[model samples]
Target chain A: MNNNQKLERGAEDIFGNWMQASMDFWNSMTGRHGGMFDPAGALAQAAQSSSDQAEKMWRSGNKMFQLWFSILGEPENLSSFAKGAEVLPGFMTQTVQQMWESFVEVHKQLLSRSTPLGQKAPASDFTQPDLNIFRTWKQIYQKEFQKFLNVPQLGLTRVYQERMQRFVDEANLFGTALAEFVRLFYVPIEKSLDIMQTKVEEMIEAGEFPEDPKELYLQWIKVLEGHYTTLLKSPQYTQVLNNMLQNLVKFRNARNELIYDALGNIPIPTNRDMDELYQEIYQLKKKVRELSRKLEAKSN
Target chain B: MNPPKIAVDLILKKLAEDTEKVRIRAQKASEVLLSPLNTDIATTPHDVVYQEDRIKLKHYKPAEVRYSTPLLVVYALINRETMLDLQPERSVVRTFLEHGLEVYMMDWGYPSRKDRYLTIDDHVNGYMDNVVDFIRARHQLPQINLMGICMGGSFSVMYAALHPEKIRNLIATVTPTNFDTDAGLLHVWTRDMDADTLVDSYGNMPGDIMNLGFLLLNPARLMIDKYMGFFENIDSKPFVENFIRMEKWIFDSPAVPGETFRQFIKDCYHQNLLIQSKMELDGKRVDLKNITMPLLNIYAKFDHLVPPRACELLTQKVGSQDVEDVCLETGHIGIYVSSKIQQQFAPKILDWLKARDGSAKTQAAGKKASGRRKSASKAKPAARSGAPATAS
Candidate 1:
């Protein structure tokens, strides 16, 4: 075979392999439950099918690199190949975007199916708040594109690309921390409030005393408020506070009677010397007025 | 299993006899424990103690009023009014009496189911108006000092505003004037409550339901945590007694009249009309500006039900030139019963009233002295007029 024809055949083979490997890697990385993409092979299955897909994608990527290398060797035909090469980069970009969109759609479907029907539909539950997958994929694509740009000796775009990726990475971390906080801390405290309210109602029914039932309940709220106020000082705790406040309002509305009934029969002890007491109270009032007037005069 | 059944039957037979003995012992113990706490105000020990509509109001001689003006205490209809005179050490009524103020507190008798249709107008203008007239006529006094507690405080504020001429001084304790604040769950719920359903379903809202709602507001401490503490402290006789007393009081809820409840929720909570000076009671505009008498407003700072916000608004809303606002650092129930209030808040309240009275007395004395000087100076002018125009 002629040298040019051999080079063309090698490029074709490498490109074909690269496309297959990219698709496999994307599927493995995005697949469910740590993705075991290969079901039949016991050894591949043992590692996880997702990893297998990634491995296949990696091999395909190597072939694409080889094809690009082969094309690089033929400087005379580089102009003819430029058109196709330009299309390939655009195609990769489009494909990555499509993959991210598909991932979000699937994530939403899974979440909806997993959530119980009884709970009040949370706004966050409709769609995953964390869009880290798209963010990270976009970063990787930008990085790869920058490498392509470097091949053409364009150096300035690399700085902008890195800065953009760093911003996205920080945002993704923040979003992740917020979601984790809501799930772990906020949700549990909200549940605790519910449990606490139920226990209070039970105690009232059972007849516990010394402290007024209403006052006792107030103390509990004060404690909860203190905890939440402290929690709100942290950015991580902000999301939890939001969730808890929402739940608290709902809980309070549902159990409004518990608070009302707590003050139902406040004991008023009226066995006293009413005449003498009134006189003393009246005398005290006289004294307070005198003190106030004197203070006001002094201030003036 | 059969052997166990046989053993159970034997145990059951023995327990049957033992149960009667246990019951008798329990009954005796209950009798002994409850005897001290039981105050049969219904059936007075002596005939001299007369009952007016099943409430024991103190009887006074006609001559007594000539020396001292009577103080009439108006208690909230939701609970018994006995709280003012609860115990000798902490009784507000006792404090007044000790200061030589003739005290007359209205004990709104236990409202029957038929009384559910009664409205705020009926209580304030009807029953309350009649009681005031009765006191006035009996004492031959044109006006009297009015002290109100909780819901009664609101009623008293309304009455004072409506009939300014009839009230000498007004004292409101733990009284809520503003319902829009977020200081308490009651304020929030009441602000947005649908009173129609509550009032329509039950002619009078059950006190138990109200109690339950209050308990739910602070469940952790009110429910499990409180009982755990109670059980731990049950060994102390005084603590147990106090606990039982409070429990009994907590559970002994009185049903609120439906119409009154409806009006209170709509006019006070949802509309927030009271503090705005736009509330109409009995077709008369209750402009708080009309409350020009000396006013003493006391509230609990830590009160969960009626926060300081609810009570302090009274001083700001009323047009009384001599308005006193005192905030006690205690919860709602504690305001009335706490030893701290007895020592501090109650005494302070008494002092405020006495100071007003003292200034008035001094003014009267100064006028009398001036009248004597003028009469001696212009003896012929008094004879010419033939009308004894002494300084009032």
Candidate 2:
């Protein structure tokens, strides 16, 4: 068998064993097998079951990687594959691997430095925060998995399958963009809270803290408004917002296309059909109104 | 780092006082909230004089008409025109009527899916022009006073420029003619928006989405502080009633037609074609120089949506020599609802219209009528002078 096929078979075997282990655990936990359930035993069994398959998977995966790298290494083969699939993702794997390491390191630092409430902590250092899990997921998916979605389909349902795949890919991208946009929106809140906490601590130290909760809320909101005003006007926030909106519109269009295709079989009319007819009617009415206005002016 | 040192006794005393205050206020607030409250808005007496395709003209007739020329007010399509008559005392419509000026307001009703194809030309040239013509024909006058608010102000500016011969006095309130300034978040955000794609996906721009955008512009204030204020003053019947009225008006948004939104975002916000007089409607350029009518352009100095820079350039660009600009110290909605600002807003418009009523005899009659109103108010208090005595 080819290295790719062998790798896929190994993956399927590993997945099957994992699913079997999960079913066994659930069945034991529910007492369906009428045994004293041992969670540790179930986990151990699951690990034991997949351990051999993992070795086979690793060997197959190594062979597949060698095959892909060999193909990507040759200038001639690279040009041929590049023309068809945009670019083979082999080139980005090294860069993504580096980024993933540094991303993990930065998050580790952040988690280590996090302080409890009522304690003096340094100002929030979101400047180098690696909060974009979606970016990592996208990179990994692109490097190892996205090509599966690009595979050509056979038979009469080829175009339908292609559209469905596109809809799913677009949805994933849109969701990632939305998450990033929401994270950017929360920056102001985070900064405001940090500042508010610091100021409140200072006030308490100086015996000037307001006793009224309402007054504290008013102060916090004022600071929050100030932070939001600055963040919203920033170029970074604007770009993130635009990206999210563009992604949303694209996702909606993809979804609409799928819906329209499905509606073609039903008796109901699609939005496209209605929109086309509406455009024609609108144009006709506009023309008639123009002509009647001209005729009325002439009569007057 | 050391923990914060707070005085226990101070906090305990304040907490005890606050708990008692909240307990008493909570009881009164519940009683007030449960009772029948008159939170209805736009309670002015008016008739639907005309309507065409989800559009209506509300004619608020005065007790005695002092001016031969009628005033037609066009409000923004983003929200309803009920904001003008939100409350009795702060009602701009009632204030105008009490001053002996006949008013006609345009209500661009909620748009449906079929209305998605409607464009700016359809609104300014088609709907607004038709309403103005209807009013002119009814009054048998060649020209009438035209006023626009916010987006409607921009439409009015376009209408006056296109059909200046039919407009005698033009008043633009909180209008955003120049859209290039980054003074407002809307201007900065809309500049990068793919309006065409948005309209293609969503047939019409939904109102709730626009409200969310507005709330995001000042989330700390609009989303949190405003609610806190409501909770703080929940025990006061007048405050609660007024707060509910405002909440109703703020959320009563109407979806803008797709084509109109696309064109507005592209032409006004992105390209800023209106102030430069390069904006086109139905192949006709909206040359601001065509607006030769006497212009009264008024805007709030503190308006975040349409800043002064956006509204201050029209008088300089328009062809009218008798253009007057008034910048009131208020926010966008405050110009219509603030008790202190409403006094200046309605009177200024009435005086401006009276001066430009085109005939000296009408001015004399209006002055005489105003003098009589002053004496009548002195003899007896105005019935709708302030908030109702009850929790309405």
Candidate 3:
């Protein structure tokens, strides 16, 4: 064969080989093969899992809202009623629907971009598509997040606004943290892909064809792991993790406040009263135990 | 002439092989994920000897009791005692029984909202001491063997120190008595944590929240690589079953009592008061120098939770002449569940207890030698025999 024909064949061969290697990587991700180094797939899975968890959380919160409304029977009859009580259920339902849709859309987008970016040719011009994904994520995040800020407050004004506002604010903080966590999978891919692109092109120029896709994959994982491990082991990461966790408490407290407020209107006892009783009983038990021991010592 | 080049064909061949390998792996993984897994963990047979509120004292009387001195196993409050008996073959309790030791375990069952006010003083001095007294009285013995694991080990240490006369021998495994070291992330995190806010919000610290902290401590390995390893070895029934059992144990964490948690984090973790002997419970100080009993402090070499430095200083601080500090080459959980660790450590404990048991057995022999020689001879032989099988 002529030199030009051989070159053409070589190009076809190179592209074909890269395609097969990419498919192998993809297979590893979808559980079609051993997922030794499938961080992106794992992140997608996490996002999907979190989406489901968030839905369950919303459902539970709605259940509390429904129970609150049912207990009152006639909201208008109450002497001191929460103004937001009327719209709270519908508001929560609408907010949850928006949140779910927005989250799923982001998840779908993440999965779509993940495979395409991973399958890109090493010799081709690599456009860091993470920028696009981030932009899309932010827009949806902001839109859905704004809905939380408008949480139908009980009794309006400042009575229940603190919790409602804090819950929304915590969501924003947590969302930011979760976004960074998900980006852990993407950043490494982008960085490693850029580096690998250079290595592959150089090898081509030198007429050296190394069948080291597996090695390349392994190196990428090492790089990814190294970056994450450093971040995870840092004091800064600890603070961030703590911040995220603390916000969860805030969110819970806000939700509980909403429930407890609604429960207050009725004659039934609440957690506050239960807590006081428990604390009192606990102190009495300790005191009784102490006194019994002292009496036994005296008798002896 | 150049030899025939087959670079393209070679790529195709590699692709074909890879595809087949991938297909095989995919099928195996699917089978694993879809198939029902029967991971029967913590299945050792035992009877509840005593009960108090939520707490139950379990006596695992072997088919034949080998040793007269009963060893009470106190597990960490974070996890269940089931960890020691995770599997039959790898059970520490079973290994101890085979060696002729009568074992009793304290099941500090799920602490409810009512238990939020329970403190460390209540656990170590009240519940633990009560259990010890009950065991001593039941057997009509002066002292019984005491063994603690992890946080339970810490409580055991405090108990042994305060009431050293009640314990014959003390064994602490993966226990962090010295909480001052910056050995683990838990230490660093808890040091700066807002414990007041946390305890106030949750009343009882949720196990799931504690789990998150532990998970984050080694997220790269524990979260990512470990799961990757699981996916790789999904086809192996033994591996999968072991993995699931471990999962159950890890997630089966109990909410720590708020008062107990508050004191532990503030005094032990934040203030580093335990080792300093500055920690106080119910107006009494916990002085480590008071622990003069025969002590066996066993810690894992590669344990991230309670690092070697966290446990290595126990022998130094403790006023025990017979303190044997054993460092097993494994992680925290691996110390109990790993066959190699169980084999190495269980035998060591048995041998140590046997030597201690010898002194007691000889005294009883001396006391009975003067009277009824015929009956005494038979009783002497019985005492000499390995754990005697009684009505279990």
Per-residue C-alpha lDDT of model 3 across residues B1-392, encoded as one tens digit per residue: 86434355666777788788778988987887788877888788888999987899998877787787899999888868888888888899899988778999999999998888899999999899889989999999999999998889999999998999999888888888787777775676676787887888888998887886677665545665567677667777777887788777878878999999999889888887888888899989999999987788887776778888888788788787667777777677767776666667788788767767736574354333322111000111111101110000
Off by over 4 Å in 1: A1-190, A193-300, B1-67, B358-392
Query: lDDT of candidate 1 vs native?
Result: 0.59
Residue B192 lDDT in candidate 2: 88
Which lDDT tens digits does candidate 1 get at residues B201-299? Answer: 456777776776666445445655567556545444555555555565565667788789999989998888899999897678989999988787877
- Interface RMSD of candidate 3, in Å, is 4.0
Q: Write the per-residue lDDT of candidate 2 for residues B245-342, one digit (tens) a residue.
A: 87788788889999999999999999999999999999999999999877888887767888889998998899877777888876777677777777
Candidate 3 lDDT over residue span A157-240, tens digit each: 666686667666666656666664455434444555677777767766665545535565566556555654555555655564
Q: What's the best-to-worst order under lDDT?
A: 2, 3, 1
CAPRI verdict on model 2?
Answer: acceptable
**lDDT per model, in order?**
0.59, 0.79, 0.72
* lDDT (Cα, tens digit) per residue for candidate 2, span A1-300: 999767655655564565456545654544432232222476656776465565456556655655565555455554454455544565477557666876675566556434332343233333324345546656655655566677898999999999998888788879888988887778768777878888888987787877777688778888888877877887777887888889899999989989999999999998889888888888888898899999999999
State in Å the error of residue A287, model 2. 1.6
Question: Which candidate leads in DockQ?
Answer: 2
Models ranked on DockQ: 2, 3, 1
